[model samples]
Target: MRATILMYHMIDTPVTPAEVRFCRTRENFRKDMQLIREAGYHVISLKTLLTAIKNNTHIPDNAIVITFDDGLACNYENALPILQEFGYSASFFVVTSKISGFNDFSWDYGFSCRRMLSTSEIIAMAQAGMDIGSHTVNHVILGKAKTQIAIHEIRDSKAMLEDALGHEIPHFAYPFGSWNPTVRDVVMTAGYTGACSTMPWPNRPDTDPYLLRRSEIKGQDAPWQFRLKLHFATNTMPPITEMRQLTRKFLEKTGVISLRKF
Candidate 1:
């Protein structure tokens, strides 16, 4: 019952140095799909994963769930065709307020602001058998935000997305993978069946549905690195990653690196 969930953000060539960590080139994405096929893995939808978790049933071995965050236009324009070619299903966690608009929030994080999916593109993907989930209305970091703000971000985004797609948005992704127990409760109380967190591990039967773990595939990852992450559920040692993150935060806080330029 162990399953690995792969998280992606943008699907295009990196235009800026900052974008490299989150953006994957189209060719690499296709190659990753081919690698999945070669590795004897089964790509499952979020709905399938959630249903199994809810019903306490068996999930296929080597199950991998693909997901994209931020609703970037390249997801529809570049990622979708390759996914269809592989006959695989993926879940997209979109920022509801940014649909059909540019990702202004990314600019604050030093990422090149990019266009987001249009309503038509989202509907088309949903019709084509993809899962559409919420990444919140503004991609707010729920762990640090106030309780009411977290509630609004969780509930309103689901409502907005459901209204747009004319169906229930059953899952959510914590923005920047930030969440606490209170935030997790809000997601469940909002009626979502499951939620994703960037915990960098494969999920097992006992895993919390609201905090399902994911491994991110970065843009600059070599094929071997990708394979390592695919097999190990993480590309780097946890302590090393934590140190790097702490250092980055310290630098940002000390005005050593501006977030917009970091």
Candidate 2:
């Protein structure tokens, strides 16, 4: 069976005007959960879905996996309650270095700094039935990093998170969705059962479990647009990703963009 993994970030006041595109309001988030139920989709944990796929077991037709990236405080303060209200389980991929730290994982291009989840909050979420996966120790983009550096990021982050939660951290999400063959190999070697990518698509049993695709949920998306996203696989995400990549290349070539501070 095919399954959709929906990606989310902040659910609070936009850190910047541009971020509003991805930051959903609390009311809209609640309604989104309602719509998922109304549409008859069963919200399942990433671990459960991946286990079913690995075993070639049957899953419901309306299966969905809810995931949040960056482990922001807003996710703990806002999104968790709403998910609990719907009795849904989610995987939150956290930047282990940032938990309980004041710094956030800033997008190389966006330069936004937001509060990350605290260590206590992460533990609480795990105890409450949410899966805590590692994003990285420092949210490094493994595609560009040296091989040893990338491996350390993947291995050490998992160790740190498992220490915090007192359980194994067996899932991951690529920082910035920037990955290549090398990055994929390191994640698997580091022991993750599966890892998520921002690339938008539903997954089948044959799909690479290490590079699972996920569709982003935008803040500006209304109910109708959300419905369209669910109904249409990939939809506008591929073209958008392509355009963004092209733009990045152009900016770098023109010396208009450079790597930002970690």
Candidate 3:
């Protein structure tokens, strides 16, 4: 079975210059959902996707999984109804530390100030059938932190989410799509069933469940660009990400940049 995972962030208007990449206008988001339907894709939850991968079962040829990062309130206010309108399920990865407060990303990324989903909103969405996954306690990039720090970020966030929701969080998405061998090992030790990455490609049964490939759906993408990305070419090049990783590593070694800046 082959499946594609789509990654998203804020689903609201771009009020600031930096939010242009992360915030998809409500009208465009609705249109994207419609486009998915018109393209004949079956939207599946993260649990179902992992189950099919584990069991090596046959899934629909056009299967796709939708996911949102940061657990922004707009997901509950703007995205959920559109998802429900089309009968689709999505996975929401929440930053445990940022819930019920303004997202801390604005200072670094130039995003407009916005509040994240409160605990009650998250619970309601989970009860309503959205998968709640962890994006770590403070949105720390695990690949750059010290071993102990990364482990704490991984395990503590999972424990926090499970404790609050009274259920296990079976999935995770590495912050900034940054991870290394050690980070993956810590994620496994933390007991998540699977993790998603920013890598752009569809997953087959043979693909590593821990490093599940995903395509980012940016606000700037047109409907046609979204369609091209699903095909694994012509819109965003995954290899360029690889090059950027190499550059980052080189800069870190030369002391030209700090890993924390990533």
Model 1's number of clashes is 0
User: What is the TM-score of candidate 2?
Assistant: 0.87
Highest lDDT: which candidate?
1
Stretch of 10 with least lDDT, candidate 1:
235-244
State the displacement of the C-alpha of residue 25, model 2, in Å, after optimal TM-score superposition: 0.9
Report the lDDT tens digits of candidate 3 across residue range 170-207. Answer: 99999999999999988988899999988777888998
Order of candidate numbers by TM-score, starting with the best: 1, 3, 2
TM-score, every prediction: 0.89, 0.87, 0.88
- Per-residue CA lDDT of model 2 for 1-262, tens digit only, reads 8788888888887777778876989998999899999998888789888898899888886788989988889899999999999999999999988887754456554737777899999999998899999898888888899999899999999999988888889999999898989999999988899999888878888879998988788888878767656655453534556767887888888777877411
For this target, which candidate reaches the highest TM-score against the unseen true structure?
1
Q: Report the candidate with higher lDDT, 2 versus 3.
A: 3
Model 3 deviation from the true structure expressed as Cα RMSD, one decimal place = 9.9
Evaluation by TM-score, superior candidate among 1 and 3? 1
* Cα deviation of 215, candidate 2, in Å: 0.5
List the pairs of residues colliding in candidate 1: none
